[model samples]
Target: MKAFDQLYQKHYPTVFRVAVKMLGDSDEAADVVQEVFLTLFQTMEKGMVVEYPLSWLYRTTLNKCIDKQKYNGRFQKLETAPEGQVEFQSIEKQETRIRVQRALGKLKPVERALAVMYSESLSYKEMAEATGIRFSSVGKTLSRTLKKLEAELKNKKYELY
Candidate 1:
């Protein structure tokens, strides 16, 4: 119990950020967080030791986000960073966020998860562990997913510059 609380305190922000990026809605992201913690608690109660709890959290969060998106059938409207988490950005930054969100919506859920992982600066090894992709394939898959996202943004006249 104490250990789980500590773990949640340390990792909650990271998990929430990933969920927000994947789901594009803080409310939905909050729901994902709740589900994630519940799963973790249940697993612990069953005496199943998670070899790598951070990886498990990331993997679970990504999977839950994918499930929520599939169930909802569309990405919710994009907004600036979650309230109080980030200071207000300039209009250009906000617009860019919106464009990126829309472009991300076009990606398959796995690709979107890969992109979020990449953006978080997670190493290829960590990404592969969290995403269950072959380690050697992480770089190639991420490159392709990024290219696809760039193409989507460009098609909408959102220049990379």
Candidate 2:
């Protein structure tokens, strides 16, 4: 119990940020994090030993994000460009964001997950472990997914030029 509490305290912020970055909603991110901890507590109660808590948390958070997106039918919504003071000459940024989100929406769920994990700088091994995919497939899957996304983005009509 004490150890679990310490783990939660130390890792909660990282978990929440990962969720938010993946899901694009602070409220949903919070929900995902809460669900993850709740599940962890249940597993611990069952005497299950987690060898890698961080990896477990990250994987769970990603799964929760996928589930939430599917449930809300918002899997297609690209995360809005970071909100803050940024100089922009026009609505190009917003249009680009929309275009990207639409293209992301076109990807199958697994491809979307792969792209997100890859973009987050997760290594192939880490991505495979987190996604429960083969380590050898991670590199190829990510490469294909990126190419698909780039192709989709380029083919879209949202040109800033």
Instruction: Encode model 1's per-residue lDDT on 24-52: one tens digit a residue.
Output: 88888999999999999999988889888
Among all windows of 10 consecutive residues in model 2, the one with the lowest summed lDDT is 77-86
- The TM-scores of all predictions, comma-separated, are 0.88, 0.75
Per residue, candidate 2 scores C-alpha lDDT tens digits across 13-84 of: 888877765665577788889999999999998999999998898788888888888898875335455444
Candidate No. with top TM-score: 1
Model 1 — which ten-residue stretch has the worst lDDT? 77-86
Q: For every candidate structure, what is the RMSD over all alpha carbons to the true structure, in angstroms?
A: 2.9, 3.7
Best by lDDT: 1
Residue pairs with colliding backbones in model 1 are none
